[model samples]
Target: MAQPDVPDCPVDALTAECLSRIFSHLRPADLAAVACTHRAWRQAVAGEEGLWRAHCEAEYCLRSPHLPAGGAASGYKAAYGAWRSEFGRYGELAGRALRAWRLVEDWTAQHFPAVAASFGMGASEAELDAAEQQLGFALPPALRVLYRVHNGQELQFDRLVDIQRTAAHESIFHGMFGGYSFYSHLVSCRMLPLRRMVKWTRTAHTQLDFPRGDKRALFAASHNFNKMVYCDAADGLVKIACVDKENCLQAVPADAAGDPARDGALRWFEAYAAALSSGAFAVEALDAENPATIGICLFPQLPPGRSEAVTEGVRVRACPLLIPELTQVAEGERQYFFAYSIRFSLLPEEEQAALRGTLAGPAGGAPLESVQLRSRYWRIRDAAGQVVNEVRGEAVVGHYPLLRPGEGEFAYQSCTHQREPAGSMEGSFRFVEGSLQAPGREFDAVCAPFRLDVPDFIF
Candidate 1:
């Protein structure tokens, strides 16, 4: 419900520099709310580049400080626009955003308790009324409820890099705007070094390009970024536009289908929530880093005379990959479970034709069109180099599948048990084919030797 309006009381009395210092502590969403209050307040805090950029980093989870590829020169606002576009590429975005935000909230509370304290508790009815009156507009129910949850965050140190490094870090309470009863009081912070910042409000009619008689105005301004988030009175739809010092505002549509949510304004509160959960707001998934994300080199050893062998004129290739899940491991016994997928793409033409003909013509000899292995076996060795176990099975996953040329993938689950903490496993799939000329022909598809070791912690 942050809309363009004039600040009437206490905020009107403060000097622009004083206002900026106080407003610097407010959350980005709160800052957006204040941006519409008046020209002076907007110029003080909403115009600062560092403010918007910091807000972007903290809200979007953006790990990189430098502008992302194709980021707008307008700074955080354009960066946010670019960021929203990137989020559209992900699947199950809403679910991921919610889960990720929950993780972020937990992490902040545990690791950065002082900063976490900035996330304010909900506002009161009077406070909501005050905010609404200041804007000369009715606050939406969702937006009112949102502010009630957290009036605004305290100052964000991670976002404001140029601030007093030692002092800001040492005094966690300095930038905080706690115990403030009024809406404008929430916008004021005292931690920053005071200075003049640019104005984000539209002062002249020439700056806006909305249709004649259109009542759209800026509710949120991207600090130093030449972009503004506005509310279109025509539809109550939140929207974003590029700002040019010399030119008029230009609306930026996010989706080809012209969906406003895709452009990043789902709703005032919903957009704020989306922004809070977006990948751009929180780039680091967790505080700890995983070494596996970098890279891993495997040097597995194979047993002698245990390699793959295919008959002449009958070409079939099996390339297997294993995915191990710690949850799949047995607790009582030292057992490891893994899902494996092997792709068969190099079957000979004659073999493929024979296989297809067998599957398509009629169910005659073997009804194995969906199964891959007729028989399979695995050999496991302990860390001490002793053969710990051997497993021989008929039909992987309880079925024998016929593999097609260049288009077939076989998947199955396997379990290996060992008494030792570490071990190695290697196996082979025995594929049996029956043709008109040759009744029974056997071929071997080798599974690469892979080592397994339990980690200290599952996560």
Candidate 2:
């Protein structure tokens, strides 16, 4: 006994907004079904762009499809359909790849904005197929997803020497992935686009002893003569082609590389992303006063890879770097040359106030009126915990830095040879509250114990 005034369909009585809200929880396939039900249902569902956008975001982790140029989201429904057709097979892997890049891009935006902008747009299926066809092989599943997310980075500068000169002047254009700079050279690493990667692979094979039926391609490299990173299609290993001596290839140990069977390119990308998330790497300002001096550096920010402490609002971060090139092993004699960097800075009053209760000495505390490096005391020990060398020095490498609050850390790198394969360094630095010229209150900034062991991953 339906009333004459009542509408025949339930949706006829409901507003479009309510219908849209109900449709939001439905899957894309179900929503498409709703669209085909009747003219009223189709009209109600067809125009709800938010619903389609939400589905795209949830499934692909993309804010916009940005398809067919002009960024016309006039039809998010079209965008969702396009994404499904393009990347549906990748599924969870595509989402993971997107999320990984998002993390790296976020870090880059916060620290080095220009470099973040250098990342190339994703490659299409046709482009990827062309690359594969040219190479006579296929990219791995995970790697395929990565390329579909971002082809790679295009370095903006001309050469490594330019980057070196820029860094020497304390001006840096971070490229690819931001790298650490010291002394005369800047070793900025950048990812190569697929086309460039293919070209480099051909060059590498031609330069080296070419192997038949093998696909070893250079995927990334420093702008200079550091090391070239490669992906092996035959074996899922991300390797570094060492240029020194025999030019031996070194793959990251399985211990550091999770799930060895996974595609090396994807593993490398995910590992880099993990490093950013875990504080193993940080983008920091090279100079304290110049915010523009910020760049990406591989100075570890967490324990194991790094040791840190704050004394009287001054923070000291020390990390060890393994020089595999200098590593010597011969009959009962194993020598490992390790270089360590000491970066210390006096915290600004405002930062100290902000870090109160969170950081050690700054907890509801006071900032240093002034600080100057005076001397260093380091106790280097071997793997057996026996003291190898005890260094008591007036100034680190001959410069006593006059620390200033809010100015960047005074960073220095020095090499030390260890008798054993592994060792540990524990030390402290003497600093005066005022300048070295004008003596005032003094304190010993503790340099927490840090390891000198060779890492599984030799980057």
Candidate 3:
């Protein structure tokens, strides 16, 4: 009774949910073609608002201002078009930046909500346009996305770290990016708000001397010192001002770290995310009494830049941090400064059982009460692997810290000079198993090599 069997269209056989999922993979144009073939496909494309919503989230990341639900394109499909018209210049990059920033913000929100709160709300298109207009040149695509995400830090809160704010803020000595203390220098780096950034850029003509035709822009600075961050608009290379050098700036290429790039802003943020994911930074309280001022330290807490070694029962962990605020280029020689942290400790009593062979006590093979550092040695090398200098000293910073068993680390920081942007430091400490007054047999505790190079990313 039936004629020859009729074939069913494969797409027609799919449920609406399945069709929506498949359409998710296709571009808007491809989906449009499917809509023309049949009424079912057309309904799926036009009626499923969630499909278009997914597309919006995938592309814009909400970097564009929200369109009212009742606006011309209330449907997500239509909203997508409206956003494209306005904020599509760096949509892909903006989306990626937004995601990475969310990760960093989430970390701050969890550990230091005060700093997170200091982040400015996203800059509007009009505001960004005005800044670029006054800046006299268009912002690079990398920076445009950053401004859209956050207009930099709020100065009042920013001063809590960069400047000597009122004592009311407590011993809080750090900002969003931490600072190091050496001699009398106490400095922290912070992002400049849009207003300050504009002012700094304008004042460069008078306050700071730049070579004629030079167009490097300043976006960040330390309040108490000449430490500043600059960017070349011509190419998005981020640089730090070398106050001691005439018209010289040090590179701080944040993306691909050390590999120079044309775009700096987005790469800068990407480098931060990489540092955070790599555990190169930590959120800690600058002042124990003020939890609100907890801030991030850019010092590397792991790998290539951080080194660890153990000899007998003594353990040494060392790391280096480039001091951008102290860069200087003078007299045919460039001097970059680095602050290094050396953390040494003796193994706990329980863990020391493995080292008893070399550390056995005189009475019953028990471990010694402590180890006394006698001398220290440092080997410094330039990026070329050539030895530049060696240091042999009686004691570190004029103190022979006793490494008592099972106690916490005896940590201190000192700085050194490197002629180039990159170099390495490795050393060993001569120690005795007993106290300084009653010394035992001497041994060397190795300090693994650690990097002393300008960071791929500043904080």
Please name the candidate that would achieve the greatest lDDT relative to the true structure.
2
Cα lDDT for residue 97, candidate 3: 77
| Model 2, span 1-459: residue lDDT tens | 431232335454457677878899999889877766656677677778788788878776667755522265547788777767778888667767877888888877776677778777888888889988988787776778887878887654433443554334232335445555444434556777888778777777776766677776677766553646766676656666542322434445442445544555665677788787666776665333345556666657677798888877888899886655455554455567677778888888887776676544543366666788999999999888888789998988788988887897788877687766688998999988788889877778889888998765555
Residue-wise lDDT of candidate 1 within 1-459, one digit each (tens)?
A: 555568654345346666767666887658767767766666655467676676566555454433334334466655655554443333233323423444535544654455456555435567666655544455434334334334444445434644635333322222221101011111112211111111122332235443455544344432222333454534444444422322222232233455333322223333323333332122111101221111100111121211222322122222121112222233453334322222233354555446554423212333333223477787778777677788898875565666544444333333444454466676676765552233355656666565554422110
Q: How accurate is candidate 3 locally (lDDT)?
A: 0.69
Quality of model 1 by C-alpha lDDT: 0.40
For each candidate, give its TM-score against the true structure. 0.31, 0.73, 0.80
Report the Cα lDDT for residue 392, model 3: 96
Q: Where is model 3 more than 4 Å wrong at Cα?
A: 1-18, 28-42, 46-57, 60-86, 155-174, 245-262, 285-294, 329-331, 354-365, 384-386, 454-459
Between the candidate structures 2 and 3, which one is better when assessed by lDDT? 2
Model 3: which residue pairs collide?
Answer: none
Candidate No. with top TM-score: 3
- What TM-score does candidate 2 reach? 0.73
Lowest lDDT sum, 10 consecutive residues, model 3, at 1-10
On TM-score, the stronger of 2 and 3 is 3
